[model samples]
Target: MIGLVMAGGKGTRMDAKEEKLLLQYKKPVVIHVIDALKSSNCFSKIMAATSDNSPNTQSLLQNNGIETIKTKGDGYVSDLNAALSYLHELTLVVSGDLPLLDGGIIKDLVASYDGGAWQSFLVTKKFLDDMNMMLEFSVNHDNKECYYTGISIVDPKKISSTNTIKETYRIIDDKRLALNLNTKRDYDLLKGA
Candidate 1:
């Protein structure tokens, strides 16, 4: 599995230098996510897709020997699809903003995946408490039901079918997926709430 981290936004919502991916917890947000993936031994390759054309993000990946993909926010699926283009195997795509996630949870997602039979699979879970409140997503059903954890396990070939990569998720569950840092409020909430 290839670990994909999406941390490229211009930090528009926060309007601060704190791009959600770079936001801090005990450490930078993206680092935590990357470390988790690395620790899982679930992915053979680790990639980060970002809108930042600067060398900062790429440098980080380069130092770690991970692949980097640049994307556009003009469309959700389009950006994701473009990033998926560089990968050819099963992949784990996650947001760079999930600071509190445990590497173990990612392993669980890898273990729970059914491969979608080339269809795609996502980690699914429910919203029941404050921790659940940290996550944001609506549960949906279509011959199935799940509140898509932003974190997903998918066949790159299947996702590559679409030309869009932004907001590519269609269905899933997993509350731990939502604690992304989008604003100072989001960061503060994460630090304490």
Candidate 2:
């Protein structure tokens, strides 16, 4: 298995001068995500997908001895496609702004993967409600409403154009997956938690 952390976003919603992935929590948000992926022991290799706009982010990852893949910074789907094109076999993709992410959640997602689906995500609705995180879209799976946790497993070889290839969902009640740092309000809530 290969792991890729998506850290190329400009984070306009964060309203910060620096990249959101560089924002300090217990540590840099990107570092927290990288640590989680490393601790999960689920990947043979772990790399970060970055873009030209985020030189600092790329430098930080490299300074920490992490490898990075440079993308166009065009958009999430486009960047994802660029990164996917280079990887083969099962690839685990995670958002870099999830400070609350940890090994257990990643482990669970990896273990639940059946290897039959083109793409799979770990999702939750109750956890989002409990954390007061709002998603513009809601998904219904297994008769339950849920939101994506920003963690997914995909067969990179199966990806032709976009990340939205045939997909599957794994509903989980894990609250750790709900704390996505998108805004100042979210950062405040995360700090409080």
Candidate 3:
């Protein structure tokens, strides 16, 4: 298994002068994610997926002794696909903005996987509302509104075969996975905490 941290986004919604992945809470946001992935002890190797949108982030990861793969600064799915092209096995994909994520949460997510082309982790809308977190987007999961946690496990080989793949949705009630810092409000909320 491999771990791939998706850190190439432009983060226009964050409205930050610096790249969002480089923004620090305790340390750089992406570092927290990389640390969690390392702590989980789940992957044989981990790499940060970067792009022209986040050159500083790429350099920082490289300087810190982490492997990195460069994409074309394309959109989310496109950039992920570009990285997946190089990763030929089960890859754990995580967003760089999930600062609160921890090793236990990641281990639990991986343990919950049974089998599928893709397994997405989500949190119910009610969970975020109770946490007073902002909801950027959502989808109908099991007839309930849920927010995608930006954590998933996928086989890169299976992705290119078709646009439609069997997806297994796992709803987790953990705040660590729910706090996606996508906007100024989300950042301020974390800062104020």
> Residue-wise lDDT of candidate 3 within 1-193, one digit each (tens)?
8989999999999999999988889899999999999999999999988999998999999998889889998788888888888988999999999999999999998888867889989999989899999666688998989989898899877775537878889999888898888998988887876
Better of 1 and 3 by TM-score: 3
Q: Poorest 10 consecutive residues of model 2 by lDDT?
A: 116-125
Residues 1-193 of candidate 2 have per-residue lDDT tens digits of: 9889999888888899898999998789999999999999999999989998788999999999888999999977789878888898799888898898899988988898877435446456666677677644567888878777677888877766563577877777665777788888888887897
Which of the two, 1 or 2, has more lDDT? 2
Ranking by lDDT: 3, 2, 1
Worst 10 residues of 3 by lDDT: 156-165
Number of the top TM-score candidate: 3
In candidate 2, which residue ranges exceed 4 Å CA deviation? 161-164
Alpha-carbon deviation at 104 in model 1, angstroms: 0.8
Each prediction's total of clashing residue pairs, residues at least 3 apart in sequence or on different chains, is 22, 0, 0
TM of each candidate vs. truth: 0.77, 0.92, 0.96
What would the TM-score be for candidate 3 when compared with the true structure? 0.96
Best by lDDT: 3
Deviation from native of the Cα of residue 16 in model 1, angstroms = 2.0
Cα RMSD, each candidate: 4.1, 1.8, 1.1
Residues 1-193 of candidate 1: C-alpha lDDT, one tens digit per residue:
8888876656566666634565667776788888888888887888988765334655666677777888875443566767877888988878777776777878777787765623233333433343544334545445433444457676766653453533333443444455667667777768784
